[model samples]
Target: MNRLYHVALSPFCRKVRLTLAEKKIEVELVEERYWDPSPDFLRRNPAGKVPVLRMDSRLMAESQAICEYLDETLPNPALIPADPEARYEVRRLCFWFDDKFNAEVTRPIMNERVWKKIRKEGYPDSRAVKSGLAAVKFHLDYMGWLLDQRRWLAGDVMTLADFAAAAHLSCLDYISDVDWNRSANVRDWYAKIKSRPAFRSLLADQLPGLPPSPQYALLDF
Candidate 1:
């Protein structure tokens, strides 16, 4: 059986999970404490990431690579676009979420609000959380602007870019950090994506002592 080593709230892991579910690939979910990696885990991924995937005889490390490989191997519901220009847009948006949005918002917020508590490292830093909250508004507005022109973030068809953006936002949503009312376009987009069959596993995830927000699992929210 295919297996995924992941933390419940990691956007990188969630991106891979979304891609796998979209492809209808069955995978065993294993929650890994990557901050304190074991020897075996380190051997699996020297980078010490949460989303180390073991499929058949292959072990995949990077989230984007794993997702792209899955899309390539299972082409029925293609997540990456075929056209080069369309593909470039998808990749661009994927990086915008995973790299830019993550750095500005997701990491700071999750680190302060979630990981610190989980790891017993320190108290939640209010200033960092506030900064993340402030930064997220800009991102939401940006997404709203994009949605104004296109059906999806990358194009008319749903793609990895949507999943990438959703992955990060979903994590924040779990913590009730996302103000869905801030952008009608983003809220409507999220509602549509959140209702997908591929999103069920993520909606069902429960972290010890850190339950999801009331609306996190609500399809109508």
Candidate 2:
């Protein structure tokens, strides 16, 4: 069986998990604390990231790379377009969510509200939490704009871009950091994504002290 070493709430791990599930790839999920890295885990991934996938005869690191490799290796249900231009758009949107959105919103809020508590680093920083809250509204509005123009972030087809966006949003939603009311379109889009079978494990995740929002596992929510 394939295996994935992951952190439950980490968006990068979530993205890889979603991709594997979408491809009908059955994997044993092993929760890993990447911050307090083990020597064996470091042997698998020098970067000490939570998402390290072991498949068939090889081990893969980096969420985007792993997803793309799966796309290329298992082409039955394609997540990336064949055309170069279309593929570029998908990659662009994936980066927008994973890099830009993460740096702007998810990391800040998760660090302040969740990671600090987990790491025993210090108390939550109200200023950082406030900034993350403020930034998320802008992101939701931007998502609304994209949804207004295209069925998905890149185009009509659901791609890695959607998974990438959902990964970050789901983490925020777990913490009740996201304001779904900010954009009805974005909310509806999220609901559609959340309803997928591939999202089940993610919705069922329970962090030790940081419980998910009440609506986290509600299918109708």
lDDT of 2 at 10: 92
lDDT of 1 by residue, 1-221 (tens): 99999998999999999999998999999998888889989999989887999999788999999988998999879999899999999999999999999999999999999999989998998999999999999999999999999989998999999999999999999999999999899999999999999999999999999999999999888
Query: Which segments of candidate 1 are over 4 A away from where they belong?
Result: none
Cα deviation at 135, candidate 1, in Å, is 0.4
Which pairs clash (backbone N, Cα, C closer than 3 Å) in model 1? none
Tell me the deviation in Å of residue 91 in model 1: 0.3
TM-score of each: 0.99, 0.97
Q: Estimate, for each residue in 40-122, the C-alpha lDDT of model 2 and write its tens digit.
A: 99999998787999998689999999999999999878999899999999999899988999998999999998988999999
Over all chains combined, what TM-score does candidate 2 have? 0.97
